[model samples]
Target chain A: MTDPSSASLSSAETDDGAEAWVDPERVSLKNVLLPLLTFSVLLLIWEAAVWQARIPAWLLPAPTVIGEAFADWWRELLTHSLVTLYETLAGFALSIALGVPLAVAVVYSPVLQKTIYPILLALQSVPKVAIAPLLALWIGFGAMPKIIVVFLVCFFPIVVSTATGLTAVPPALMDLIRSLSASPYQTFVKARFPTAMPHIFVGLKIAITFAVIGAVIGEFVGSESGLGYLILVSSSQSRTPLAFAALVVLTLMSIVLYYAVEYIERLMVPWATKT
Target chain B: MLASSSLEVVTTAGSIDRPKAGARAVTKIQIFDLYKTYATRTGRTTALQKVDLDIRENEFIALVGPSGCGKSTLLKLITALIKPSRGKILLGGTLLDKPSREVGIVFQQPVLMPWRGVLDNVLLPAEILGLDMTEAKARARELLELVGLGGFEDRYPGELSGGMQQRAAICRGLVHNPSVLLMDEPFAALDAMTREDLGFELLRIWERHRKTVVFVTHNISEAILLSDRVVAMSPRPGRIEKVIDIVLPRPRTLDMQFSPEFKAHSDEIRALIRRT
Candidate 1:
């Protein structure tokens, strides 16, 4: 008991120390001001360096120019951002919808896991970027191909994490449940699934971060309208500022989606984030 | 290893209050020549052999041994979490091949789900057993109160101290009101002070609502202090070495441990363990 308790500190009290508890989610001015200040300083340095050097606009646009382009192409940016967001959301949703159930199967069925795991790992090895063109070629340049690429990138992590969480139920907890004569399904619903929630959210968060990148890659391969397409067309046409604006929008989308998952995690599994 | 075709499993040390022949009716758990062996890479390791014991209804029996002793294996066997390699365990005279709802267990760790609140954690067994939620919740509240965790129902396991968490775990073990409560060194993880406090708390809880308890601990004083009888076992091929009935008065006080009788019991147990 002594050594085992010391060993499983990760599962033990990693967080709840004697230090007074701070609500992790509450937004404070000190938290926002530091990042905001750093961002402003970086942007100022870039803007000043660009102005002093008189760098060619096509080579690198100043923050002001990017901001101007952002304002000038507001309508276009909004349309493209919405399209990219749709693909990202759709692809991520698909991954989660398919991935979680697949994880449960992998955890429960050894035969299924043995058969499918190697194939999954192999597919993971083939770069999502490499798969994008093939996906586009097969599906013929639409939201479907981009969504599939997004799905591909998001799929592996979700399944891996979900499976890990599902299988990593504390042995003592399993014993306790076993002592109750809980049916497999009952054990799953009552114990395994809830135990896996924090872990599942970890996968979901990682997959969500990849979701936008996947959509952009799909658009880069071949697409009509999206931030990826906008960046591609604008940069090829020497609309550097416009492309930068699109890139910025994509980044914002990624951050927003990541936070959305985190917010959901905080809401659903409040006990998990206590650390 | 000595060759012995016939083995005497039960060893009653000093004076024992032998129950009448009709006492079989009160026997909640009957272990008959129970053996457990684990097939390891080297060879088959016998964890327990020819262990016979009868735990009476509401009797508090503590199984004490050093590390590698099969006290834990015995507890699991009684819970039917793992089947004995040989012999049999009968719970209330029925052959216990699989774990039933009648057995409740608390491990060394709290094992409370971090995600669940204290109330929900306590009510888990009730939920699993398909008991009435309302009644179970009522009983759960009562139990938490019994353990002095009355106002902490909404708190998560992480927010509680180690002793508090174990107290909640005890509440959980007793929530379903199981006939047999198997605790495997439940207080061994806490600091010495918290361990003692929780030991008293457990005795208080056990006294009010009695259940057949088989408490396993390496702590000699703890086993002696909490149990009605201390079943001391040896290591390696784990078998009962001696069973000493604690004749200490009810509502056992800490001062009783300093008494000559307690010292005599501890010395005898210490000697038996050291002889190996």
Candidate 2:
């Protein structure tokens, strides 16, 4: 006697009334203004400390001296900075390309997971920096060594976080999909992968920071170009202010990459429940 | 048995007296000699034992039992989500070997994909079913409207209230137009008022579609109110203890809940549930 189809159909209607998605406005002047003001205040304090304390310039150059050095070598440092950025981005992209598919493969196949996981853990345990010299010798001094080092630093977190996310689906959630009689492939595409996005972003964010570090490390041990090379040159010549400027630029590059990743995470996973 | 013609006349009269529809079809679901056991590092533990049941088509049956009673496991078995250690499940006179598109499931949590909007979550099954996306989206909109969640089509699951989220989940389950809806305490996370509202809404929908539903719930009152038959279960090597039939009239209302018949059914089911 019941019209089961209509009942289910209208119950679907009941849900349609509650959804409310809105476009959040983008970052505005107020956002940039606050941070800029804070940075200025910090700079002013550093300058005042140097002027008042009369600290030896060799040990800790004044803000004015660092600023002058930054201006003096702006063109040269910018070129090197761009090279490092290019290496970092390429390495990060490569890590994502390799890591995500590998994570998926591991999640879907237990045999592959069992054989590969322990090996990965052991590989991660080996200090990557210690292997940098050998890698340089093998690959030579072109971009390859630096890119490989960056890839090494950035790949693990992506794979680990992505794998965790894929596997960490709650049992109840799986039940919801299972009862639907969803095919294994359907379940993965519709439920498991989407659920893993936020976790993947976490891994990517961490890896990006380390990617920059890896590129710098590659330059530190053996490289003809990059901010790292500039650091070596400035430090050896006892141009501490120039070294300080290079260091500042390195920190700024890392921060920019970190924030860029964070921004992408926000865009890609706005509905992240944990956040 | 009543004479066929006379039975038809009687049913017609009974239906006229009622305000809503009745079962649209009879779906036979049989669980014969079902057994599930697990061998942990500690030892062997049985989850279900000698469970036998025959569910007639279009019956809204509620399974109520203690934790670890294998109620969820039973649902899993029927849906072919897991292989029974030894047993058989028959739907419409055919053995259930794999998960079928004829069944829709709503789990305890909303479990809506956080990255998908409300409408997209509801359309998930359609996507999986390889159904037409445009048609599915249109149907999804209608289903959302039925649940009183209209105009919320674009919102993410995180933006919805608990009750609202569950409502969206229910829409997702029913969207694929499956013949059977399996709910594992789908409203358990909701507040009392929301639970009551959803219970009635679910009944209204069931009345319209008459799909066979097997609901798992811990709430005695909920089981009594929603089910045509309440299957009471016992824990550890879980067994079906009793099956109590509700003979109350159709289009059951909140007022009937206060009537003697409703209370008697509730009390009897509660007593049976506590016996274990």
Candidate 3:
């Protein structure tokens, strides 16, 4: 059947000329502009409130003061930010390397799933922040503790998503491969894995944001470096503006990393987005 | 009387009693008292019981019945996707234990890999079989062209219409040059016009290839239009009630479906199915 919606959409485009064609672009522009405008208004009100109330800089710094503090300590902040970025990437990579195979095993073997799935769920239920201190105690205060903690935090989501994805093959698709007398390995490599890619990416997206939090928590427990440590030191020293600057940098980093996963997902499995 | 004994007698007698025109046709598949029982959490349900059929080479047979008549179960059994509880399936006089390369299957859904383009999807069996990729690619291209999807080879499954995807799936089932093609309600998901169009396309392909086809469908007209034999099945404890031979001549057209002979065959099968 001719798609009624698409037929109407094309007709609307024709009737409205370039305007209908540009509708999505216009919406995207509004999306960005509206958010920025709201943020600017909030910042203006905060600045006016701080100034009019004669609040001390140590209590609540104005937006301009925070910006100036960010510029003044940009070099130090960049160094600490790089440290946090490294820990996040390293831990996230470790999670993928370990979690995927574990997920595969869980999906393929009922024995392993029955035995290990509960353990994983239990482990995930435990507050990750509680384990950070133990990890720091065991691995020492270097990058190792931070990386391990990040790995621990990111591991569960990847494993769960991967397992779900691997097992979610449609019965029809499974039948298609099986009717070919395909070896189990061939079935997995060609059909199951490719089908699971979108799901795996979803896990990666969630795990990545958690990886940032994990790294920061690792820093909070022990690390002498990283943006988390910078925030800790600045706030303790009553350098509120510098702490806000470090927090802002950390937020930007998390956004960048999340999008990076999304970008790769688009490249690897473009077909998934359409479905 | 055991179905297996009768099946054996029929297999030998049919080969010996072949007419001069049918002399070259040999038995391609022989099912001896095949039975399938599914064991669920509750208990066991018999899907097919005491089914016996002998399929000739290059013959087109259609399995038609009400829903849950084990038409699909029989197809799966023939393809060796699932094991039969009791019976022997012989391919060219050899006992079949697993999915054989000589048999290809098309399910109700196209089941095309969304990631792979149409050409790659058709070549999937070759890849799984580890055949020569270069030759498989050439055959894939020819099959695509044959199916009227000549220029759409590079397109993904999502990009194609439902009918086009099913056509591509049919090309996939035939790409390996299998001797027997098993289709389980392949066009059941398409619109009426698309189904008719695909039916004609399938007949054209069968005319050229002459592969033994075992098609399962609920549509009585579809069975009469495309098959040399229509096997009517009973529901629940699925059993072959009757096998009606269509005497309609080859290269059958869509208009032939409205003919008096075709109507007689259709009515006869419908009555047989309704009786039980």
User: Which candidate ranks first by lDDT, i.e. highest?
Assistant: 3
Candidate 3: stretches off by over 4 Å:
A1-22, B1-23
Better of 2 and 3 by DockQ: 3
C-alpha lDDT of all candidate models, in order: 0.86, 0.82, 0.88
The deviation in Å at residue A155 for candidate 2 is 1.2
lDDT of 2 at A136: 88
Ranking by TM-score: 3, 1, 2
Model 1 stretches astray by more than 4 angstroms: A1-31, B1-25
Compose the digit string of candidate 2's lDDT tens values, residues B143-222. Answer: 88877888789887776777788889999988888888899888899888778888988988887776889999988888
lDDT string, candidate 1, B70-172, tens digits: 9999999988889999999899989999997888899999989888899999999999889999999999999988877888898888777787889899999
Instruction: Please give, for residues A15-87, the per-residue lDDT of candidate 2 as tens digits.
Output: 5545424222434566778899999999999889988998877778988999899899899889899988988
- Clash pairs (backbone) in predicted model 1: none
Candidate 1, residue B136: how far the Cα is off, in Å = 2.1
Fnat for the candidates in order: 0.68, 0.52, 0.58
lDDT tens readout by residue for model 3, A1-275: 33323533454566568665567788989999999999999999999999999998889999999999988999999999999999999999999999999999999999999999999999999998999999878889999889988898899999999999998888987887887888999989998899889899999999999999999999999878999999999999999999999999999999999999998998999999762
RMSD of each: 4.7, 6.6, 3.8
Residue by residue across A22-112, what tens digits does model 1's lDDT show? 6655547669988999999999999999999999888899999999998899999999999999999999999999999999999999999
lDDT of 3 by residue, B39-93 (tens): 9898999999999998888888899999888999999888888899999999989
List of chain A TM-scores, every candidate: 0.90, 0.82, 0.92
Highest TM-score: give the candidate number. Answer: 3
